[model samples]
Target chain A: MTVQDSLLAPDLPFPIFQISQTVRRYLLYDINTVTWLRRTHNILGVFIGSLPQSPQQNVFFGLPMELQPEEATLLVEKGLAFIADDFRTHKQAVRSPPRAMANYKATARKEALATAKAVTKQKQLKTQEVLQRLNVRQGTPDADNTVDNDEPDESIFDTSTQETSSRPVSSSVIPYSSTPTTSYPPIPTPSKQSSLPLPEVSASSYALFKHLHALGYFMSPGLRFGCQFSVYPGDPLRFHSHFLAMGHDWDEEIDILDLIGGGRLGTGVKKGWLIGGAVKNSDDNEKHVATSEDGQSEIGRKPGDFHVRTFCVEWSGM
Target chain B: MGDLQPSALTAYIEASRPVGVLPQDSHHHALAAQVLHNLQYQHDWTDLRIHTDSSHSARPLLKPLVSGLPPHRIYVHPDEQIEMLKQSVQEKDVPSEREWVLPTHLRETWSLRKFAELFDGIDPVPPAENQASEEKPPFPTAKGGIGSRRGGKRLMLATVGDDSTVVYYVVHDGIVKPRQN
Candidate 1:
């Protein structure tokens, strides 16, 4: 569902609105789609940080969708989209399992527990046999051995924790949560989504987004052309996208494959692949961060302190 | 339940790993599942179906492809647009309504031949609701020789980025006339 549909939901737990950024006159607060959609009134903003995938997908491919910065700013004025916390990042705090995720954990935990008990029992038997070979006497007799067999050593689970730390085990009360074979991070026992708010835009992308927004280009997600944003001269339906734009940090090195692949995709589709970055204003580098704290509105927008530079990549068929 | 979570499809996938129900190739299933989720929720798409194995040829699709009925018009058929133009309707856009979703991963590379195989296996429209269950998706109606949008080809390539963002672009087999803006 779009962010607008989510805000209509009445049962959302309290979501703390974190200040993410500010561009021009707009206040870019970070809210998940639910709040961003409903609270923000679908006014426009790129809903970033998580795509709707199943718990099964989370357990397997946990890739989350990021919001294009231009879309984020674009949505605020229109009240259609919202900058949601990256679901992938907050999933580290997966509190609620819903039905499916709970089921996976229930089954996986049971499987792990059963396996844990069986393996421990075998170790007990082997240890007992070793005593027999050495002619050792048991003070507690078979009764003690049977009792030990009845209770699986909980310590085995502690060792399992060392091997797989991603599991969000609420407590040791639930057994077999640390299943080594199970690739899923321990589903926090409850199925509730995280209530924490977050900042959606990265520094460099936000800078580029602000730069492009100032230049008056309609920007949307450009994953279609393997770029960060797709620049449009007008509303997307009215015109084909003009450029596949991407933003990077000043010192970051881009891979050659990205250059070739991006160039090819752009040329094939007849669009330019635009790359850009925020170059720190060397004259006043230290004061830039200090100046970003202008007000309660922007905690992001550090790009203002640096000059933004960009260029279009067109494939030259020599 | 999706209030604080991501999309409804996410809830659906997390619901269970029904034994023998989901397709193999964890990544393929992941890509298809993402597209299916986006269709069902993001764009109000319905009647979704998935195809992992191919019936037309010996080779299965590199990944599963999807087909569904879009809530809004996706593409404007050229002939239909011409008819609309003749009537002089201000809004020439009409939903193509039904189409196929070609699920792809960004990390993977695509050559012309690979795209040809995909086009060769697909149809002008999505599978019918009834027959959809009887067979896997990707029922090619008429032969669409691949080029650009050249031969009136239609396939929405749903490419999934590592970040879980699935951006869809209308990919035609060959270069077709530029639609009247």
Candidate 2:
């Protein structure tokens, strides 16, 4: 046979011309012998109703029991053909675009929100159960003053459940798993916590601290209380709450808000201004600490160095 | 989950360290201090401080100095926004800002009574504008920008997690008109 005919035919060593002329369609050595053998085996496999259980284990039943290595390749190739159609179909299915991906995402968001809600509900139920359990335990003589440090004070946390859960039910808002009541480190005692100024700091001082605290700024608790929050250096006020407040005024409230609504401070009643904070004064006797160029404690205060202080008031009526 | 993280702030959880010899088992204060440092560097906040409860029955406070920043409407009632908008047209100047958000964080569970205690300590408006004055003025006269008028607005609360993620929320002391979604 020519190379073209041999390429098209299964690799085998036999006489093709003589085989066609003969009855079994097989010659002592012919290129089409493997094809004929595979067709035979395929028939037997289908007949047995159990295709070779695995690709690796597949053995054409009619192949010579003991074939040379070269002949072994032919038998394996034949077995591969039996399953090629199924493999091709699977591949095409995998490559095709998913029909429901978008729908899946939408459903996922809904599911997440549902899960979050469920978690909240479950937590509430668990809390109620624990509370009841506590009440019963407390009634027992052994339960007196058994304040467990491991658990949150349910009285404080439990009372707010109605208010906290009452928040509008937004769909699919899963609370990040990392956030939990457990994650909060146990709070420290007041006197040992920080060297920071005491609550004894005037109402205005404490108020400023609370306002800044709420705004995500942190300061040195040990030192004289100072207004210091995290921000890019050189421009400390870049993300300061004051900056946000000003923007809110300019964007939403002020008409001629050239400087945060040219409205006068203290025009409104009950202000929550952030008065002076912790800092070092220049003079040993300097009652008020002066500010540096960056609004921090002066780098090196001379006897004459001054301090910076911020004050605010709530104003109403245009 | 839609996989969209709505939180604007990010955080890192430092491995818990041994609390050496601080009195009153105050290791959490040190952790909070570390968190405060991270917030200042990462979130661009100024004048951040941690205030623990004096009564020991309350949680520690993470306070930020946000006087002029623009963030979420810390406090809002959908109903209040409409009233403010209606009044906006007749106002002499621009309308007043609605919420006064504080850039703060919470790590412990809080009671409303404790919250009220905190609220009681705080003024409806922020402190007076002394920081707005000059650094070395011969006299303690008010300078720069002070007395700027605005409403008793909402406060943006940035609650930090140990894993370095900050979940933000809006909070108000008393009842205010509700806002639209």
Candidate 3:
């Protein structure tokens, strides 16, 4: 791909993978790839992982560069990079290993305990029936064996019903399989389990990023510059950053000190400070359902493309 | 779940070799690690070298000195700032420049005396861009360009907050003329 091409080279888009949590990594093939990113795009992600630099070993593991979720998500949406599995998709997939493992382990433990309890109770009842049948057979010397088998099954069904009634609703639906739970460790409810449900920082930050990228402004996490994002009016190599952008939500309260601090920093760097939030529409139910998927589609279109309203804050020093 | 990171900042520092023997104190090392991490990633610095040997002077630095070359020049000497200002007035584009970055954390406060000591050890301009930078004074006492850069022996003060927000301020060793608005 021609590096000098004015339009973004669609072919050169990097591949970003969400490794764990806030960390995401991009596998870079060579040192020159880093040099190109550093000098051209102004994409200054850190080298979080590397192999020993030696010529003797033909196996040179590519350098792994790291960026925050805010940075990673933007790179993907802008078509500057494509993620392995979008964070949003991975997040909602209950099958993802980490959370799934924990959830499964706890569920398996609870089911096992309930099954053990029911099995012991059922076995005791079985022994009692067997003993009574033995006594009856001894007394009658010819009680029909088929009738005895039939009688015990009805009683076994009654005992199973009792077990179902006593066990938790989660464990009671399947009747016949007394399958032992796998040897999975017990998992406590995750920290997020009890917290109120809301699309968090990742979602909102992504919303802001999507809005800006659509506007054609290249942006990166403002962490280095003390804001939520830094908006570049043009390719970073050609122009200084134009704005220090901060993102919040409609209902979230912002600190005045933050405004003043952001404004002062903007003034110092000769850039405008932008504070923004995703506009809350009147339809609460639609928004509630769309919150997660809202990031992907623009069909839930409000009056304007700017679902987020950004206002400039420039400090006027007295 | 999104916020948690194995936090490879420390290990990255070790691999980058910002310097060996980071700090005896865990807190100091951690603070140094954070700044170095940001410098490498956020600022796009290369060849980061950390200094923990307090043996540079009497009264060891409150923390370590992190030096690296930012992808772009971050500071302007008084003379260079003046040259750029003059060029801009003359209708010419000011040339791009690069500076060696001295990374610092946000929580640490510094007095003038402390700053002067830091000024003592390092060159006013980083050694990386020596061809264009060598002639410039290591530290100039004159007033700098109009509200552009701080004067005197200056260093880029990179203060990283707990939320990983880093703000850079150009600090001078002593008073200089405040630029006219």
Candidate 4:
């Protein structure tokens, strides 16, 4: 395959795990794979995980990245990704050897101990420097050497001293017996037989997403913007979204007031309001239903089965 | 009937007489009253009441919240739905729970802190009324009364636009499993 073909359909497809069935949440947890998806396939999922650096603050988030159903469906259709039921995989992991779990705990405890020791050493050094400065100010620099010699070795491991320090140790530094909720042990790749069928999205919305994606626009969920999807000309990290897109069926009624509201809102934010849908006649609709009834998955259907038409609306000063 | 008269809405708001609301924040009570009126009349919700004090802290809430029973259940947690399906429970057979409604203007800007504060003030389920003897149990007893464990604390965020159109979105206290489309 040429480079362009590889971009559309990679030889080794990535796995998108279906964590929840009801809400149809597809998440990709591996950061390296997330970067690869963006660079190679132009797929940009939202990071919905809390940041470890500042878990209390909501301004910045971390992984696992959440993919729109349309994005997951498109990736599966293109032979670039597959969906697996993570809950099933998790159940399987629970049945694995207890020795593996013990090993994981041991490693975590060792890491935590090292971190705590490092923090204590750093604090002790800071305290020694402060004492030396005070000795110099008193014109008794010799006392600094005595103070250093008098430093108690037991104080390094003393819990009371650490607790009485001006800066209390953060909870993150203390090792707890319970495993962290966020971390998971590595599991074997799920077999093809265990892979789930791609998620089902509204036909019109999928068509609109595929059309915009084909034209090189990256999209993200537009719930924050009060729209279906936010369209970006380049990677969202490097560029602002250019449009707030809404999809409809070809014969669906268009509310003029809703259109005006969308246009005005989009213009106020320097974005255009985009509306689009797949044009399907009655015959095509019947054929689609017939094919589904014949036990053919949506992936077996062709993208060229319908043509999508899109229009961009912006408020005019006049 | 004709469009609801502004004078009637004003009279209803006055009659509600929401207490413990600060003078400057009286507009919030009016907003909650407007939503309560809509829920009771337009939506056919029953057992409607406006709350000015926090159920947990007993302190005045950031704003008034309207609690009522809708004609039908507005939301069913995905996990709860699966459990009900396994038990072969009919959709109509599942008793409806009272919903907490947070009323606000569409033009208002909301932040995560504001939402967090609101969620902190309320209980997972709104308190049941003492006078309603005819009301059915909130949940079937066979399921061990899964009250709020499966579906965390949530509220109906009612944002009223300038056109008097109230749009509601389910706002949960924390991450809840997504429901299938």
Model number with the top lDDT: 4
Candidate 1 lDDT, B1-181, residue by residue in tens: 4458656566666553234744357657766777788778777877888876554556666668788877555555445456557766433133234667777777665543345456556555555668644343332223331111122445676766777776665555432322333
Per-prediction share of native contacts kept: 0.00, 0.00, 0.00, 0.00
Model 3 ranges with Cα > 4 A deviation? A1-14, A21-63, A74-82, A85-201, A282-306, B1-181
Q: Give a tens-digit lDDT track for model 4, residues B64-139.
A: 8899888776776666777778877776776667888888787675443355456667887787666573357656
For model 2, the stretches where C-alpha displacement exceeds 4 angstroms are A1-318, B1-80, B83-107, B128-130, B133-156
Using TM-score as the measure, the top candidate is 4
Poorest stretch of ten by lDDT in candidate 3 chain A: A189-198
- Fnat for model 4 comes to 0.00
List candidate 4 stretches off by more than 4 Å.
A1-11, A51-56, A120-185, A282-304, B1-181
Task: DockQ for every model, please.
Answer: 0.01, 0.01, 0.02, 0.01
lDDT of 4 by residue, A1-318 (tens): 477645554235767899887878999877767777788678988888985667686756778888999999988888778898899977887776888878877887887677776776687677767655655665465555555543543354456555535465554466544445555564555555688987989987898898778767899999988899999878998988878888877767565455557766876787767777775554534433454322334454465655455555454321
Model 1 stretches astray by more than 4 angstroms: A1-318, B1-11, B16-18, B21-24, B77-82, B89-95, B131-151
Scored against the true structure, residue B8 in model 4 reaches a CA lDDT of: 78
Comparing 1 with 4 on lDDT, the higher-scoring candidate is 4
TM-score for chain B of each model, two decimals: 0.70, 0.44, 0.60, 0.83
For residue A83, give model 4's deviation from the true position in Å. Answer: 1.5
Per-model interface RMSD values are 15.0, 17.1, 16.2, 17.5
